[model samples]
Target: MIASWRPGREIRYHTSLNEALANPAPLVLALDGGVFPFRGALERLLSEVQKPGVSLAYSSYETDSGTVEALPFNGDITERFPFGPLRAYLSERLIPTGAERFRFAWEYHARLALEEQGLFPSAIPEPLYFHAPDLLPRPDLREYLDSRQCQSGPDLAESFAYLRYPPEADAEFREAFYAMLRRRGAFLEDLEPERTFPPGKGENEVMASVLIPVRNRESFIAQAIESALSQDFEDYEVIVVDNASEDRTRDVVRGFRDPRLRLIENPPGSIAFALNAGLRAARGKYILQLDSDDAYTPETVSRMVSFMEENLGCGLAISYYQLTDENMNPLPDGVVKHLEYDRNNILRCEGAGAVRCWRKEVLLEIGGFDEEFGNYGEDYDAVLKVSERYEVCRVHKVLYFYRRHQGSQDAVQSKAERLNAKTRIRLRALERRKKLVQNRGNKRNTEGA
Candidate 1:
């Protein structure tokens, strides 16, 4: 076996395959700790590795909960290491899976590194290992991007190598990575219609309470208010929580004499706090959010309500939205159309559109928009929390207009602050997932003898 000369740190991963490469061992079976390989699992893996181009092989396994995660190998998803630890590898084809130097991402990067070199991992569609999935989420590019080193070079090349990205795409990769980083600040449409409510719902009760948390939005407040007032649905109210606006925002909202409109004088502070105030005052079964600077179409609320009504299990609903300038001129095409709720992709980008609606009960359960997240990331945090336990539906129609003006939060947020916010949100999401798993385990145990 080729022993590694890696010094300074002791992480328990093989540094290089050179030792295994030099040894006569034809096949190496890799299994994660706490995972039990079933009989013939190694043999089945071996049988596949003997075939051409099958550099690495992993098999489906039953999680501790008794359900199997029989995932097909997608080269892209290797970033998350969906291929759990029950695997077999050909000795000669082994790449530097990663050394003990950087403990976390090397494992996932190894999968990607191997794939970049045409080592497509072929999957064995049989249950091989018995283990529970890790409660922690896989490391994302943020792992690489969030390194606190003061860059001594124009680009992060050496760190890229450490992260196992191919050197050729450094410039292009930095651009793409930065592009996604820039987008972390954008809040997109991530909702629904219809007429039906649950059996106990009162006919006179508000169907949906559209909450607009506003502060100093004189220019766009009228448009937003008009949009809410114009919704075609029956039995809905608009609560414009004026967060101590210095401008004519209060005046603008007061100008509207609609009986359904209510104004709350919430002193300026956090948007989360404002949202909570609105929630406390909201009189509807469903709570929908509208930014002070954004607006909805006449049918946006109706459509969102209908969707949530039909998909009773969905705790939240967001729809597609068109990005336009302040004047409502449509932005050019190629904007990231957040059409689906890909769990991993959504983490990297807020593919969930901006216009969001939640079940009032669910909102209260999660403590109403997480006041800790404050200005930028509250919605994302809320979306993820509900999504982990309950389904989050995506409405295919663009029933909301996300205005991109000079005053837009994304445009105004400083780069360092944005990065810092995202870092915290990602960590919190992981921590939340871990707690969720623990909670599930505890519930199941309590229900047992």
Candidate 2:
């Protein structure tokens, strides 16, 4: 319940978080169920919270496996609560009047907002507590979605607030989020019209190209290849760019005798490199994504291609996908569609969706995927790039199968690795959004003149 090296001071217990926040103490420590502070943990948190203008403070914590260093505070914290156990000193006077009416679901929601109110966060450089594995929250997509009490709205702000903290669907919170984004200059009134692509589609061009970037995914490569080859839509080539796989991944591609499936070998490099190489070789008007470890439904290519073809303004098309086991059995969550894919809020969430299809000419115009992202955030970077310049629409149908198995790249990433990747990606996106808002303002000014 307490650290061994605790400061010899009187401590009081409150029945709930609200009660603790209501206390008149200069500092308060809030811990998740079964969280045990390590030696000197409270001392560190207390020191941080006592600093002038500090609203909330946190230190890294240990789990069953290892210590998780908390991510450094940033604008990304607005949408995602990245801290674990934390200390707070946000008395009612410190918060803006009427802000309390929002009734945030977690103390984090209230504390994070204080940053905008001129308060700041502090972090200790090391682990301070032990988080019991059993007590940790593992929120499933389906369960979380079903539990959300918010209604659908055309405004991305409402959805953003709902998704960020589903338990508190306050209208005031949604408006606050919108105002925050507007203040950051990341608010967008509308997407720019589609930029004109180069003159014409190249000679002998296919309607679409299913691009598969692979490395040591021999087990799943064949199924992914088959899914692309068996698509209901014709006139599409399956371009499998092997990133110097040490396994039989290339050989499996060779077994598929379909001329429509072409395997391009590349020097061992990042997924971005492999994808750029495929993009260069692709002769399709549209480039569809098919990961080596994932498969698509027979109509995925058709649906995505049709949607893009019908809507010339759309530069990127994202379709819903079904979560499956390694053997391809459907997961309990079933279809995972991010209905929150507004052009503006694309900066808020993870991404549009899986089975993304891009306009080949638009991909060329944007210079393909940015190799700077290397492997981790190339797709996300691409999405952000495309969304900025043109409309990104969604298809409601389940067009892809996202497999949750050990071999999938995302399935094996450490929490720290994911956090680092996300931080970089989000920072880049935030900058891009600011620029978008700036450019829009400049354009309006010119038009007014």
For 337-376, candidate 2 gives per-residue lDDT tens digits of: 9886676666656677888999988888888988877677
Q: What tens digits encode model 1's per-residue C-alpha lDDT throughout 343-400? A: 4345545438757889988878777788776888888888877776567778888888
In each prediction, how many residue pairs overlap at the backbone (N, C-alpha, C within less than 3 A)? Answer: 17, 0
Please give each candidate's TM-score: 0.58, 0.82
User: What TM value does model 1 have?
Assistant: 0.58
Among all candidates shown, the one with the greatest lDDT: 2
Q: Give the TM-score of candidate 2.
A: 0.82
Stretches of candidate 2 exceeding 4 Å from the true structure: 1-22, 28-30, 37-40, 52-55, 62-75, 89-99, 105-120, 133-176, 195-202
